[model samples]
Target chain A: MSTEANRLPTATLPGGHLDCTGCTHRTDDWKTGPTATFLGLLLFIVYSTAAAFQGEHYMYENYLSPMYSPVVFTQLERTVTTPEGETLKVAIPGAAPVEHAWFGLKPDAWPEWLPFSPAFLILAFPGAFRFTCYYYRKAYYRSFWANPIGCAVGPFRRGLYRGETHLLLFQNLHRYALYFAIVFIGILYYDAYMGFFRHGEFGVGLGSIVLLLNATFLACYTFGCHSFRHLVGGRLNWFSKSPLAHALWKRASFLNERHMFFAWLSLFWVGFTDFFVRATSMGWIPDISTWG
Target chain B: MAERTFEIWRGDRSGGEFKEYTEEVDEGMVVLDMLHRIQARQANDLSIRWNCKAGKCGSCSMEINGMPRLACMTRMNQLPAEGKIKVQPMKTFPLIKDLVTDVSWNYRQNERIRPFKPPAPDSDGKYRFQQADADRVQEFRKCIECFLCQNTCHVLRDHRKQEHFVGPRFMIRVASLEMHPLDTDDRIPDLKNEFGSGWCNITRCCTEVCPESINITDNGIIPMKERVVDRYYDPVARILRAITGGGKKLPTA
Candidate 1:
């Protein structure tokens, strides 16, 4: 008897149990359904289409009213001086009382290797496309493709690739990527610091500083990631006796644990910070004070 | 006093579907409690998977009304009685009978991660570790292997990219051990190339659904990604790699 059966006694489910919703007695193996995967494909289609068309309806925004912080949506209108010197009202919002992203004056693309800017977007495309994934193939097959609901493949019982190739011979990119991620975080920190006191006063703003900190944490966590270490040489199957190498690895792993936490906090905070800035610029939140 | 409806799945691998039944309900009952009622008073041989119904073992994860949740912890009162509760197996793994999936593969992946072997201990066999050092790793070990995060992640839940990506849950496991201050194995390269660590776009659905509140992406996945970048893309490191014939010569622990 499997652990599951041992834990459960024979019982009747009239109104039924959640775990037994689609269950039967064939507990030893798994099957698949391409139809379920197709359904998942369909869901993606709907989602992507919605995303494409959701760009902007006149570039207007939803913001809280100064008078009623959480309960109201107020429209922000802004005027900016054009390169030709005439100030005009642009439906798009996002400008502090005296500050602006100056997007109209921004460069289209800097370089293919620059981080977060249009540069990295263009550069990362090749890698992204090359690594088109298969994370939920089993689920899609069962849930959406209308295929038989079961495991696509059984447990592994073979050689290196058959299991997780411990002594990964050619997988070093993950570690390399980590250092650059750290550097990226450092640059973001610099950007935040530059913005922090650039105005000669101790407070150019803490908003950017906070963003920098979030970036810093994400960068640190990403550097400490296991994937990178794996690529670097985590699978050195013959080096079990080497003390120093093992020591660095333990240290890396330690940081990586903290990495997971900061990675998330930063991901969420970045989105929120972006939204907050946009709201403040568009006249949503009046004068976000310079205090920390 | 009240009759509740259950939508149970009634088919096997070849083909099957949801079969509903209505029965009397009770107070302070959980979804698992209802299923037990069904199995005892209704279907005598019905198969369901669970253990430690207190939500500790993670054996009872299922789609409760379209959301990934622990059925044992789901209170019937919290659900809308106006509709039939939809329960399904975790979409990311292979389903066995119904809600049970072939999560055994995850366990195998867990083993693939080099087990923790501390660096040479000081003289004697015993070693000492500071509480501050072990605190964070212990926190990550709280995961019960529920795979709910894997089930709800759009990448694994909708996109079939397992061949190229290991889900956030496994990444969390790797991170947990890697973070152990005394662990003596390197896992970064395997994380990048073999495990397909870069596939996570950080949507963080895994982080969102984690019952343990572990930050799979921020604390685990991104850090791994950053390390990968450091190895291959960082100019100085790349030059060093070229000069040193790759950095694999370094020993772990």
Candidate 2:
């Protein structure tokens, strides 16, 4: 069978149809969508990277930054002399003390060359989860990869497109990454719960509310994940017999519809929560609380 | 009543240009109505393919102001109050004449899809799936086959991967069947390889431009991709199937 015979005579317009980026017939402003996505994702990446490496100001009283949740090991509250002979503060203000760390003090095997942050231990799980997300795939593919730039717009690369078939085959592991994400959601909720108690005294603070909302938004995003939707209800062929699965599938479908909304909301709120914790810890903002 | 200008693409596969037509716009005129008036008054030979002018027949699909939309469904009030309403044939397929493209390519693609094959009826000699089961695939049945999704899909529109990808419309068709409780045929291998499911980057232009507002990417294509992953990519699932000698006997391509 001749595949060429199936092809029709394409339009003689400039750039043809596929490469017609500057075609005058296009009346919609196509650049705005991809431009917004590019700037939004770029901002998130930069802010998250700086916050993760800072290692300090991640905790304020009982509130921990979502970036540094499931704190693995913490260093002692003491000043250290740097290689430059400058005094560096090892004790971060408002951070959970070494006693509060799940595994206690930082190990002696810790390399001197590497800067340690609790975020380094756990950020990968959530980061990989988002990177491989079905929604984020669309977001970054259009914005960053310029796969088509916009719906009808021409792409930057003109070569044969492999899409997610080749090197991106690892994207198939998104469901596995989702398991890690679900686990992280549980850890985040625990952190949020810890935020409600300051030194074992039940209390409400601006920081506590911030942490709680962060957990809620992240929960909405994680639960609304496409992979989660498939796992809960999509895999079943017989919804008639499986009443419970059908019910959960319906709920998941509802959230799945708003997955993109929750994705951006959770992303922005997580960054804001980190900033709020950092601000209060650094004495830049006051944490109004019953503990006061 | 108000005067509105339309820049409708005129001509055929040989050549074409946007020919401007100014007409009187009524209170509740749709783009299709304006096109009819223009065809009646100015260019009597002006060509457009439409039926059921109520947007249900899935005809009269064209690029309105650079967005793929059904002309009958797009009201003049919904568009910018000022500016020429640009109307053009769906760019993905070959142009035949003004506002009409050779959409037979879509029909050929449709013919390639395997038809729904439900399992044999029970002892009562009747299908017994609940409404809940039918409701899921019913969303896909809402598709009017406008091929607006095919037009808007960058995989077909920009990348011209029609030889590779089957576009979004057929993906949902396969999803509707695959997710059917009684359907036993397996198209997973074809979905990954021949159908070029991977070609879809999930940019979701198909969902956005869909007149039916189908969640084509999140609900349909992504689920299909996950199934392909389960069959071909998942190592744990493969190991489990190996150890237990348990897995569906997928039909060989």
Candidate 3:
């Protein structure tokens, strides 16, 4: 040990705490991660919101947009007599023909004020699932809510950090939302199956592949859920006795590890699937099909 | 050898200021190595708390350049080459002296959590379980009581909700016991009220700073939160339990 004379005088801290939030001493460009997350999530929100509002261009041939799957009710296909005395059917370009709708036509009791978009009926279930997702809660909390902005960084809002307890108590409903999402996956898979057939003819098309990939991606995301993982095996006290649940939990854990990747990928693919169906319906892109 | 400057905070509970010291850095030197050099050559009274300098002990946790990191694990090469390194005690905990903190609060939090209560052994006196059962709880056991997750948690660091929230370190402790294959204690009530699991916003700062790379947010905390929901908030689960008379009934205190 050195002599006492070698000791330096104790320095006084300005405040008890270092106030290191947003400190310049941090060498890493920490802002980049949250910024990228913000931009990516914002892009998805904007595009999905616009697509959900667009009532038309959701179906072409036998292919349906994942956004508008299980099409509840649709407008009737219009018909007019040509100059040559031939009756020709006309649909809002790319809109699903009346016969394709599960329910023949838009319900007469539908409130006029509410928009007639099939996407409006179904988006909320999957939306709630993704919104309350354990990974997405982290993503949006940092990127959107600016909860501490980034690790050790100062937050945009300071006082009354209730943190999912008060209004966000709804977030606990994520497990319930998982049930709805599982059902949606089944419906989407059915739509994918329908994509394989155009007017009763079994054939493959670009649209068929798009719908198939959309359903598959959504399935991966839904199955990889944190709550799903818990339900599968986490609730159990003994994995040795429940071999099936143990295996399922292992698979879910594997998928849960990549939940963030699948979350973003599926979000992007869902949007792209809608855009593809819309474009194909509008005749902007021809359906590359074996039928053709 | 290359000369480097370190701005080290030196003070007690009253206050502190960063004092700069220059030292020669060798190849493969960690931040702790440089601090040891400064202690030996310059400030003989320089204070630091460390054990098992290989990063397992987790005693040398400090804020290096504003990020909570283990000094023993933070290699000098990983830091930026140009700037002076800033070293300070963890902000969430009260500073005792220099880099040593009054980490007694963490121990107190650990004390509050109930220990694991497993079922009685079989007739052969063997507590046997499958490797898969052990594997789930094993991930949480890897935690070395680093308190890095606790330090980096915004609920404790920024909001200072220590009275309510048990911080990430203890949350995982509870997760390990709660998810154990044989352990059958019901801490869910305590987790909701006393431990304040809801205070965690799932910002994932704790997960990000974990040296053990434990999936604290996803695998640990969220699962616990879902359990809380099942007991307290989920009407569907409540209805199912009512109809079936089949769910893990909360143990009476």
The residue-by-residue lDDT of candidate 2 on B1-253, one tens digit each, is 7899887777787766677788999999999999999999888988999999998999899988878899999999999889877778888888888888888988887888888787789999998877877887888999999999998887788767889999999999989988887788888888988898988889898998989988898888998998888788889867866887855732111
**Model 2: per-residue lDDT, tens digit, A1-292?**
0011112134445212434443334566777888999999999999999998888888877989999888888765646899999998765655557766889877879887888888889899999999999999999988998876777666656466777888898999998999998898888888889889988999999888888899899888888888888778777777877788778878888888898899999999999999999998899989899999
User: How many backbone clashes are present in model 3?
Assistant: 3
What total of clashing residue pairs does each candidate reach?
A: 103, 0, 3
Stretch of 10 with least lDDT, candidate 2 chain A: A1-10
Question: How much is the lDDT of residue B21 in candidate 3?
Answer: 86
DockQ computed for model 3 against the true two-chain complex using alpha carbons: 0.47
| Candidate 1 lDDT score at position B103 | 76
What proportion of the true contacts does each candidate reproduce? 0.04, 0.44, 0.48
Task: Give lDDT: candidate 2, residue B133.
Answer: 77
Q: Candidate 1 chain B: minimum summed lDDT over ten consecutive residues — where? A: B244-253
Q: How large is the interface RMSD of candidate 1? A: 13.1
Q: State the DockQ, from 0 to 1, for candidate 1.
A: 0.07
Q: Per-residue lDDT of B162-190 in model 1, one digit per residue for the tens?
A: 67667788887777766666776677788
Sorted by lDDT (best first), the order is 3, 2, 1
